[model samples]
Target: MNSGTKQHPWSRYVALGDSFTEGIGDPEPASLGGYRGWADRIAEVLSAGTDDFAYANLAVRGKVLRQIVDEQIEPVLSLRPNLITISAGGNDVIRPRSDPDEVAVRCEAAIERLKRDNATIVLFTGPDLGFSPVFRGVRGRIAIYNENLRAIAVRQECVVADLWALTEIQDPRMWAPDRLHLNALGHHAVARSVLSALNVANVLQAYDPEPMPDGTWRGARTDDLVWARTYLAPWLLRRARRQSSGDNLLPKRPTALSLNGPRA
Candidate 1:
């Protein structure tokens, strides 16, 4: 997907956050951690024509906002990247009784720390999930968080990849089977958005969704039952046990490296 040939100004880029940044839904067996997400795709474009460019991804699945700031921030400082993209707090906002305002405060603190080096920062607004069956209840909370991010980006003078406004994400075809994460198509759309926000030219193009399968009302209900039984139940159980998908996992790319060989 590294189609850009023009020289971009960024020499170093680092991605930070949770599953979304880690490229969970878009699996790649050849990639580190079996994922090649939007961050990796963007890296390919950014690395083009830049001989000294390096990229690192510190995102892990199931990481909360506090963990991301407390754990990943220090490593980012050490990397001293000229460009950074962070998408955190989605895991927090979805929790019961979680306060979007409080989450935003923590996020702003992280933003303040990252700004110290005067690097170009890109922030993401969570995608609108109102169209999702399982996540529709949390749509309001996500919206509030998205607004906070928009304000933070303006105040911090950071670039924004506004996923809330990315209408393509609302389509069910753009998501993975889990419904919580984006599929390959969704990740591609996000990569495009990030490139647009950064004003970097790339040859990435839009992809059409596969044709929807015909279904009856009973079939839809049956699918919902299967989804809940498979994904939702397990996720709830994990929360009850205070378990995480990233419990024993490490960052796919813990340090900046050349994007010259492999994909992720």
Candidate 2:
């Protein structure tokens, strides 16, 4: 499939945020940083017909809004990209006692600084987690944050990749085994949304994950117990210790360079 007639205006693009932008769950060992995330997917589509198109991703995992503003802004400014996508505040929003409004304020500050060069900025809303057995408890908080992000997009004159409205992601199949980050299917869904938000046409297709076999109630409970022990318990321990999964990790693709991937 080919891209649509709408020609995108950007030649240089940069991505900034946490694990969602970093491609945490979609492991591609051959790709830079060993992941082909939504940003990378977008870069591929945007670079399809243009040799001059260049991209950079400065997103590290486990970064809060303030950390993103502090750590990523300088590198992005240095890139001087014409297009930028940022998905911050998710980490903050999920933390205990964190205020969504405050997170939005920090996000606005970041956007204010980023748009100084008149770049087309794109912001992402956190997904609706109403279907997640683990994260459903925080659904209301995420909704508030999404509203804040929508308002920020309007005031900042930026585009919004409204993940909160993408109903396809509400399924557990769209999530990674850890249930925090997106799997490949979820990342692809996000890439498609980003392109739509930019009004860029692409050939990416909707994918349906293989259906899970039905399980007995006891089996499901046992699975949950195993998940808690393997993935959840360690995560809680890290939070207790004030540690992060991305501690000391560097950006996968820090420089803006032409992408090489399967064309649309």
Candidate 3:
């Protein structure tokens, strides 16, 4: 007589980031198919054979770096994820103050916390916004943030995905209309890129040919891709313009209202 039981190979993953990580505007109904975010795609690619692997996407739209560290990340760690993917700092760099040092500190803290649990961590640098017309002034800020991120990744011995350089040369159409988030094709590209980095870092096992597609996997079609790309890309561009203009129109604070204002 034998007992019946199944064992899962790679079951637990935790994803951390802001809007991009959350797959904002990818579409409604967060299922396996239809606008699957990169993290979900990665989880699927890696956990193809195992039922044990589970992914928890803790990303919140519009979340800045510090907010994620304080609100979302701590609770996720209690679950003891085996793998963690963090794609934060975009909101931090885009904010008016956009303090790179502060962002780095929070990211470092997240990494340390995850490492304490013996989790394999992957940190994603922001995509280069140099191509975006509205994000021109903050382009330099992105570079600074990447530098800090790279230093921290090195120190923590974690994997760093250089999405900044990869997406920079790609066509702007790869981005959604918002010009910030990625469309389906872009998400697929990101998934491949991140998977490759994980493989290179020896965090993930080499890919084996997947079995014949059961009715389970619902890959997005061209029409879905086009719609996502066409609609969201422009929307992102418009949003970026509004944000840039708002930054430009901001009035200088009165001395009394400023933190450094009115010397005692």
lDDT of each: 0.88, 0.86, 0.62
Best prediction by lDDT: 1
lDDT of 2 by residue, 1-264 (tens): 244534678999999999999999989897799998888988988887776889999999998777899999999999999999999989888888888888888889899999989999999888888887777878888989889889988998999998988998887777777877888888888898889999988878887334345678898789788888988999999989989899999999999988764443
Once superposed on the true structure, which residue ranges of model 3 sit more than 4 Å away at CA? 1-9, 28-35, 200-264
Give per-residue CA lDDT, model 3, range 1-264, as digits (tens). 012212333457777776666665354354422345666666655554444556667766666666778766776787678777888778767767768778778778878877977788888887777666667788888888899999998999898888886752255545564555775556656776786777622122222212223232244345346655775565467556643212222111101110111100
The regions of model 1 sitting more than 4 angstroms off are: 1-4, 208-222, 261-264
Q: What is the clash tally of candidate 1?
A: 0
In model 3, where is the ten-residue run with the lowest total lDDT? 255-264
Pairwise lDDT winner, candidates 1 and 3: 1
RMSD of 2: 1.9
The true-versus-predicted C-alpha distance at residue 203 of model 3, in Å, is 18
lDDT value for model 2: 0.86
**What are the candidates' C-alpha RMSDs?**
2.4, 1.9, 14.1
Worst 10 residues of 1 by lDDT: 206-215
lDDT of 1 by residue, 136-193 (tens): 8999999999999999999999999999999988888787878878888889889989
Question: Candidates' TM-scores?
Answer: 0.93, 0.94, 0.70
